[model samples]
Target: MMDVLIETRGLTRNYGEICALKPLDLRVNNGEWLSIMGHSGSGKSTLLNLLGGLDRPSDGFIRVGGEDLRVLSEDGMARYRREFVGIIFQQHHLIPYLTAVENIMMAQYFHSVPDEAEARTALERVGLGHRLKNRPGELSGGEQQRVCIARAIINSPRLLLGDEPTGNLDHGSTRVVMELLSELRAEEQFTIIMVTHNHEVAAWGDRTIYLDDGVMVREELKGD
Candidate 1:
């Protein structure tokens, strides 16, 4: 059995005539945090999507927590997406009508039976207990993003995948969110792969990878 939590070999992705990603090799150990940085159309998002199972790779081996995503069926992949990978989109995709807790509850419904108690606890974990009753429109941007994060982790996923989670926030809020992400990652012991263009945000990860033209060009490990 491989000790690596995530390992991809010769991963390739394409969209029509456009080559979204080239054959790439990447590895992430258990409980490690990895960040991918690149400019727009550089295949950063494509790599994250493939890792999270939102998009299938044209060619590659994708292993997450012992499961080979490349071989999973559609239903199996959906289950993996719900139970194994937690995703944080750049846009806080909370329902407009649902309150913070309700939004999390909806996520629960998709993955399994809704557990209000667990949903509430997830919101509280993100320091949004006070705003649980407030809808996304009523809460601040940071708070909404926190709710999104809470929803993402409600299932206790083994891998937390994020795509520019703090891209829309201010510096202070970005710091707060990044700090919260770092804290939760340490406490939950989950592997994290975040894609971002911000250097500061990438600095929060254990390793930073630079992608250009669908290829990984640079990587470095940071000491705490």
Candidate 2:
């Protein structure tokens, strides 16, 4: 059996009278790839935010690596995110002034001492060896996103979370990014959970869970 890496029970998030997440229950095992799908207001992002400790749940439990997120303080959550969770968004969010190499190194610097050599290796792994010195403004959208991926994994996170990673890219770039994500996940063996609206894109995941109005509606497993 696969080892469970993420677990949630009755997880919920609320904003005033609006309930963004309604007691969601989910489990993702280590090295597994999961996609989340839902309508615009389906609370998919909210779910991702809660799992990533970007937001707190109003009720229920969230356990990753045997640590309950609810019990963590602000600093604790920041430490958790730095050490255990890697996050990506449709926006590359790269520093405009920094080169790809520098962007990757920034992560290392914040968490601890920076390793320039390791940062370069990470960019090379993402097939950006030739663009290591290129700043975000100089690189194409796809290249910038690759740099983001390299930065995300530089710390060797145990879980990778993405929100609309390909939402703004063209079809070709979407495929390119997805392929890179798959390759890296396999090489690193981190659990991945992506939130996307495109069914075709969601199909790339090993399993997919559908959401509606903050509730888990269904799940589909495509593993053979």
Candidate 3:
């Protein structure tokens, strides 16, 4: 049986009077690729932020890889984010002044020690070895995203969270990025939770769940 890697019980978040996410109970099995689909304001990003330890829930609990986020201190949560979770945003989030390899090394720096060789290897893994010295502006959109992927995985995080990771790419680039993610997942066995509005992108996962108005309204396993 697949072990539960992430679980949330009555997980909720509020922005003053606005409830961004309703009380939610969810579980994600280890090594599973789970896709989240929702319209704007459906709380997908909110949930991702909560799971990644970037934001705290106003109520309830989140447990991932044996750590209870509710019980963790601010520093503890930061450690969890650095050591356990990798996040990719629609924007590549690379520093404009940094080269591709340097951008990846930055993530390593935050995690612990930065090793240029390790950073170069990560860039190579993402097919950016030749562009190591290129800044984000000097690379194509697809290449920039590849650099982001390398940076995200440099720490070998157990959980990878993607928020519309391909939203900024064209169809071909989208396919390339998704395929690369699949390849990485196959080799690394890291659990992936991706949020996207695109059905085709959601199809890349093992299962897909749809959120509507902050509620999980539908869920489908692959081949169902």
CA lDDT, every prediction? 0.90, 0.91, 0.94
Clash list (residue pairs), candidate 3: none
Q: Supply the TM-score for candidate 1.
A: 0.96
Task: State the lDDT at 78 in candidate 2.
Answer: 94
The candidates, ranked best first by TM-score, are 3, 2, 1
TM-score winner, 1 or 2: 2
lDDT by residue (111-191, candidate 3, tens digit) is 999999999999898888899999999999899989988888999999999999999999999999999999999999999
Q: Return the TM-score for each candidate structure.
A: 0.96, 0.97, 0.98
The clash count for each model shown is 0, 0, 0
Best by TM-score: 3
The sequence of per-residue lDDT tens digits that candidate 1 reaches over residues 131-164 is: 8899999999899899999998999899999999
lDDT of 2 at 70: 95
Candidate 3 local Cα displacement, residue 69, angstroms: 0.6
TM-score of 2: 0.97
